[model samples]
Target chain A: MDSYGLLIDFSACIGCKACMKACKEANNLPGDPGDHLSYSDYTVVKQQGDVFYRQMCMHCLTPTCVSVCPVGAMAKSPEGAITYDGSKCFGCRYCMVACPFSIPKYEWNKAVPVVRKCILCYSRIKEGKEPACAWVCPMGATRFGKRDRLLEIAHTRIARWPDRYIDHVFGEQEVGGTSVLMISPIAFSDIGMRNTLPNEPLPNLTWTILRKIPNIVITGGIVVGGVWWVINRRMELEKENSNGKEGKVEK
Target chain B: MGRKGKLKNKLFLFLPISLMALLGLFLTFKRFYYGLGSVTNLSDAFPWGLWVGFDVVCGVALAAGGFILTAIVYLFNAERYKPVLRPAILTAFLGYILVAVGLLFDLGKPWNIWHPMVMYNPHSVMFEVAWCVILYLSVLALEFGSIVAEALKWKKVVNIFHAVAVPLVLTGVLLSTLHQSSLGSLFLIVPQKLHPLWYSSLLPLHFFLSAVAVGFATVILESYTSSKFLKRGLELDLLVDLGRFLWFALVVHLTVRWQDLFVSGALANYRPGSLEAIAFNLEMALLIGAVVLLTIRRTHRSKLGLFFAAMFALFGVIVNRLNVSIVGMLSDTQSGYFPAFSEIIITAFLAMMGFVAFFTCVHFLPIFPQEDHNAKAELKVQLSA
Candidate 1:
């Protein structure tokens, strides 16, 4: 299966938010929610000094929202698109807590605002088109393709001009390899990539603990149940014995 | 059977009902007319508030009394504590239901809450936790239902229930253990986001221990509160037995708390002026006070002192929950988030529900044993001697 990935080279990137504008247009998003969290602005471009950073869904190998969602409202396709379903969302906001990137935003102002986030424009891709953001990035900073080819592009650049790029590819191992990759002159962690996070998927951390809950329930239930049965059985027997003694006294 | 009556016929039910009715009306109006934005102090920085933290987490923790006390008396066969079983079960029943109400209000799309069950997010911890809570609530309802049936003279039904109660009690305890710890596990994912002092991979263990300690404390308060209102004498023998359990659990909890602190290797966070330090000390002080009070045979035996200790434990539990949910939110602060007056009303209303249910059950119901007969029998024996 094809795993769609984006490699952003901050060193080559100029701080033009044309990609963000194109995403807004392609998604047919209505602008400026009375609340910024709703109404479908799928992508944003953030700048720190000379560097321009593009922000959107990482299409994480293990999306926290997927793990924490009680319903299957949030899903990650085998092809690696992180997807959402408004109809199924209970609007628990647990996904918001679980997401490391903090990308999912809620429409709290509405009677019911399901969580909103980037979806890689899978529909557009299925129709033989690149994501709107990549198509509009004239500088070629954000390019979408198979991850192996993207890694080749990243390594070639580093070898060609060693000092121009850091020795790291940001998404290669971050949160179990986000589909969106980055090569930057500055440290990725400084730009909020969370370098200290584990190389494994984020879900692995919580799942280890969660998986044991059922076991605890089963074992603890037996112990408690066993005790209750023994005690109650003894109580019933004693009452029965007492009744027999009263019958003898009557005779 | 003749003495038994409906909850509405009971004395002292007036105030809690009136308070609840008014608050319910306000909350309903606010929810429909204005929406969640008009209510809670929730923001991108904090998506949880009193509804989630207090009503659900702290409320459920306090409600642990049902399983905690039952495990002691039924599972462990501490018959000395049997007098408290009925009241503790009553509190647990109300506490879990109120938690459900709080959760319904907290949901952003409450209308779709059934999505979890139907949609089946197998990977989600929430999916697991939600199922567990629902099951546990049913178990609690059944546990308490037996006592109610017994009171209502439905002995045939009660007999059937009595047969299955041990199994139900086991299920309830197991369910309680899972969800109680899962509440802490909810925060474990936000390790970087939460203040280091509050977040731990061992959050499940921490949550379980704290709840056990709180469970014992709440029973203490409920006993005193019931005795005063129902005009029954305080059970000193039971209190002493309960005091021993409280001391043991508190010591284990303290040891774990310190163990967590030591393993973190963040000793500097424990300094006098750090926000974490103050909260740490305050919670510890309250918990330590509970422990110390239990050690004193005279104070542990005193109804007034015992009640205060229980109150202190409740305070400690509340402080810890708030620290995790609000103060420990790991994200940078966002602009302007304050809970609307409507949210406050809703919180108050839940408390009112708890009081109303508690008061109603105690009066005109066999929630408290017939202490008068027992006391008279004891007096007659002493006179004969």
Candidate 2:
């Protein structure tokens, strides 16, 4: 099966934020050159010290936002973008909480708000064009291609310049392999990225407990039911003995 | 008092509540029309605020008295506890209704609230919570409806409800267990965001255990307050026994919490003067205080002492939930969130609605089981002599 992904080299980025502007124009989102992501901004160019990092959705192989959505509003597409349909959403905001990278942004200002996030330019990709951010990068910092190719490119860049780049690829195996991979000149955590996420997907953590509900309910019901019968029966016998009668029996 | 005096008393009581509810309704209308941003202090950094923390989490835990009493009376056949069961169920029913109302206001698209009903997502913890709450509320209705039927002299309906009472109560218990834990499961994902002290793989277990403890405590508080306000039987003996059960529940909760912390090795993150630390200490102190008070023979025997212990336990659970959902998330961020005035007003309004509904039920319905308080008082006097 064909897979798609983005490989961003922070070492090559110039912090120009041209890609951020292009993303805004392409998505028809409001304009603001900020370091943090917001509802009106799908992507942002964050500068930490001397290095520039583009922040957006990771679109995990096992996305917790997709898993935790009660109304099946979010889903991972076959073409490799995490897509969302707000029409089916009840706006529980579990997606905003479940996201490891905190990618999802809420339009709290809107009367009928839904979760907003990076769709990875899935529509542009379908039309045989690169994502707006990738297309506008003059420095060739943001590369878009197949998921396997991106991994190969990330590793090659890291290996080609051992002294210039960090040894690690940020999203290669983080919270189970995100489609948006990153190779940084410095530590990823130094640039506001969470470093301690387990390689395993986070949805599995919640599912582990939720899967046991059926067994607990069944066993708990039987035990409580048994106790009820025994106690009530004993009470009935004691009453009959004392009164020398049926003790106000009824169905 | 004369009829005019009685009317004056009721007006005095309901006037403020009605005003608050109306004000809350006006704000709610504005909230829907203008959006959450206009009213709430929610942001991307802190998406959840007072409504999610208090109205949903704490409110549901407080309502747990219903399921606890149901299990004690119907499941364990503890008939001595029967007098408080109807009131407990009524509290739970109103509590859950308020939870739903809170969600309605909290959601971005309030009109699309029924999406979960049609769309199924088994993987989500919220799906379980939604389904469980909906089903449990229905069960609670039937349970409460039986009381209404009894009061209204509908013997046939009362008999039919009684025939199905066992299954209904059991269903309610199962549903309560699932959702109570699922509320905690909702926070399991944000390990980096939530403080290490509050976050754990065993969060669901902690939530369930604390809810059970809070449930018993709420029963005591409700009964005490009801008797005081409504001039009804105190049922002190039953409340004392319930207080004893609260002690055991609190012990189990504290034991499991400390054990989980130890096993997870999260104690390393404990900073003595940190906000998380202070909140954690306060929560522990309240629960421990309740346990200690209830353990002493004299305190457990006295209604006033039992009331204080129950209040402390309830407060502990409330703080614990808020700490987990809101305060825990604040540790990692430079910016902090506090609820807006509208949010606080709405919460108070809902609480007032619950109090009003509870008393209305007590006034009209045969909620307290037919027990001879005077005879019980005489027996206590005789035993003491």
Candidate 3:
């Protein structure tokens, strides 16, 4: 299915944070001056040395949070949003460990808490509108379009500004390709983003080990069962032979 | 056997248990009423704290004794080990119950803990863990139930349980192995998050191997404790036999771990003076010490030496689990986590409750085979003579 994606050109962002304010208002979240994403905040804009970086969910193609959730509470939607279902979340927080981006935040203050993260404004996409963050970006730093078209846009910008931009698109291949792409002038790591994530998905690492369990169990069972049978049969035979000897002695 | 005599005998244990239980109850109520932020030091950067790291993870690791003993006694037909099987199963059953209770307290919506049973995410390691723990707990109950039947003179019920004992024990073993490894699998996604020393592709194998060693060590510790307090003499031969197995498991585990480190080029992680390095060294030392002591005939022959070795091994497992769950995950920037007063009190209560349950089972159930008592009495007379 055709999927949508977002591209954030850090060089173009003015650090204004209008996107953050618009997102809070659009999602009906509490207004706060804080620059970190929390349960009450879906997205934020942080400034590091005159560059503004939008911090939110990457909405990964092979979403680790979705795979690690015991109840399928976190999900990757067909519309390219990484959605969350509070009704299915029982607060195990395995998703917290599994997310490569460390995106999912818990409602820790509430007695009944749920995981919270960016949904890429799936509701708006369903209504044929842009995400609030993308719509509010005045410099066109945050652009939303089809996933293929976004990749083209991100690459074209980087190729056109070789001296101005880094020769990389941060999320294009990070942790098996995220829907949130970025083009930055400085190194991704310098701006506090994890740049060393493996190109393959994180979930595959666990699966590689888990896949052997069924084989081990079956083989282990057979081996153990065989040993038990042999030992019991030998003991029974020894008992029978001793009974025969006693009968002969009595005779 | 007198009422006043019995009360006095257990007075020491009951005082601490009652106090801790009361405190734990009060704090637990506050936690549920006021929410996690009012109780724990957890935040977005530190989502998990003492309850998950210590109470649940360490609890499960320590409870591996039941599966190990059950497999040896039933599947391998080592009837000599059968005496300790019931006690092991009882400990495991209590351990799992405590783990479940710990999860309830740690979870934000404690009431929805059962959602995994119906929701069914096969890809999730946690889903496997949830199912395995629930299934294995049932297996332990049934296995321990046979002991209850025998103790209460329900011969027919005992016979029925015995008929299905082999399969029941095997299922327990399978389930135990799955969850124990899955606990390690839980860390697999956090390669960047977890320190390289502890994180490896062989994490699941490391968890399983260490658990096997811990299982044998816990059995030795339990036997030692029972012998001291319950006035029963040590089962010298059985303890030594288990010690040999413990040694073997340690050797295999250490070998594989070092090999994994070498292959992964993570040997550089052993920079001396780092907290992770120190913890890693201490854990390795304990494992090596236990292995050395267990290999020596003199050490295994003496109950005191065996007890120390077992204690060391058990501590090693504890240290390793804590390092993986809490210490290794700590990045320099994030605020460190320390167990709140409520967390510590609840953990102490759970441990106390395990001891209480063990004592109750020993008093009421046929935990040890009858012949061991006769043998012990004979040995005691010979020693006195």
Chain B TM-score per candidate, please: 0.87, 0.92, 0.92
Q: List the residue pairs that clash in candidate 1.
A: A67-B124, B193-B330
Highest-lDDT candidate: 2
lDDT tens digits, residues B352-379, model 3? 8777887787776656434556644343
TM-score of chain A of each: 0.89, 0.93, 0.94
| lDDT for residue A223 in candidate 3, whole number 0-100 | 76
- Candidate 1 chain A has its poorest 10 consecutive residues by lDDT at A32-41
iRMSD computed for candidate 2: 3.3
Which residue ranges in model 3 land beyond 4 Å of their true spot? Answer: A245-251, B1-11, B368-385
Interface CA RMSD of each prediction in angstroms: 4.2, 3.3, 4.3
For residues A131-239, could you state the per-residue lDDT of candidate 1 as single tens digits?
8888888899999888788988998888898898889988788778888888988888767667667777878778898777667767777776777668766766676
Ranking by lDDT: 2, 3, 1
The number of clashing residue pairs in model 3 is 0
How far does residue A187 in candidate 1 sit from its true spot (Å)? 2.4
Q: What is the DockQ for all candidates, taken in turn? A: 0.50, 0.62, 0.55
User: In candidate 2, which residue ranges exceed 4 Å CA deviation?
Assistant: A32-35, A236-251, B1-8, B229-234, B369-385
- Give the Cα error of residue B351 in candidate 1, in Å: 1.3
Q: Rank the candidates by TM-score, best first.
A: 2, 3, 1
